[model samples]
Target: MSIPLVIFLFAWFVFLVIFTFLALVSVVQMLRFGVAGPGTYLSTVTFLAVTGLVLGGVGLYLAGVDWNATLDIALTPLL
Candidate 1:
C-alpha cells in the first residue's frame, strides 16, 4: 500500500509478464525452427524463462498476501 511497496509489486508483475511472454516465444520459435535453427540457445532461453516465470509467480502471490511481512521473511535469511 505504501509507495515503495506498490512500485515493487508493479515491477514484479511486469517482470512476470515479460518472463511468461519470453517463455512462450522461445517455445514457439524452437518448435518452428527446430534444433537446427537457434538450437541450444533457444533451449537455454526457454529454461531461464520458465524458471523466472515460476519464481516470479510465487513472488507475486506472496506480495499479494502481505507484502511487508513477505519481504521481511524473504530478506531475513539473507541478512
Candidate 2:
C-alpha cells in the first residue's frame, strides 16, 4: 500500500478508537446519573456509538480492497 493510504487508514483507525472510547464514557455517565430528565442524551449518544462502530468496521473492510476499484465503483453514479 502507498504511504498516503497507510496514513489515511491509520488516522481512520485512531479516530474510530477515540470515538468508541468517548461513547463508552458517555454510557457510563448516563448509567451513573440514571434515567433522569428526558433521556434524549443517552439515546443520542448510543446512536452515535452504534453508527461509529458500523462505519469503522466498513472502513477497515475497505482498507483491504483496491482503492482504485472501490472509488470507481463508488463514484460511478456521479460520472
Candidate 3:
C-alpha cells in the first residue's frame, strides 16, 4: 500500500476504535452505575469525546483524503 493510504487507514482505524470504546463506556456506565461511582462523569466525558472525534473524522474525510473514498463502501449499492 502507498504511504498515504497506510496513514489514512491508521488514522481512520484509530478514530473508529476510540469512538467505539467511548460509546461502550457510556452505555455501560448508564446501565451499571447511573449517577454513582463517578460513572456519570466518565460517561459524559466519553460521550462528548466521541462526538468530537466523529465530527473531526468527518471533516478530515471530506477535506479530500483520497483514502477516505473507501467510506462509500458503506453506502454503496449492494448486489
Model 1 clash pairs?
none
Mark the 10 consecutive residues where model 1 has the least summed lDDT: 67-76
Best by TM-score: 2
Which residue pairs in candidate 3 collide? Answer: none
Candidate 3 whole-model C-alpha lDDT, 0 to 1: 0.69
lDDT of each: 0.69, 0.69, 0.69
Q: Give the TM-score of candidate 3.
A: 0.37
Expressed as tens digits, the lDDT of each residue in 1-79 for candidate 1 is 2244555778977987997798779767767667665666767677878797878888687756754533433344553
- Residue runs of model 3 more than 4 Å from their true location after superposition: 35-53, 56-60, 68-79
Clashes of each: 0, 0, 0
RMSD of each: 6.6, 6.3, 10.8
How much is the lDDT of residue 4 in candidate 2? 39
Tens digits of per-residue lDDT for model 3, 1-79: 2244556668877987997798777677676767576667776777778778877887787667566343434555778
Once model 1 is optimally superposed onto the true structure by TM-score, how far is the C-alpha of residue 27 displaced, in angstroms? 1.1
Worst window of 10 by summed lDDT in candidate 3: 67-76
Residue 52 displacement (Å), model 3: 6.8
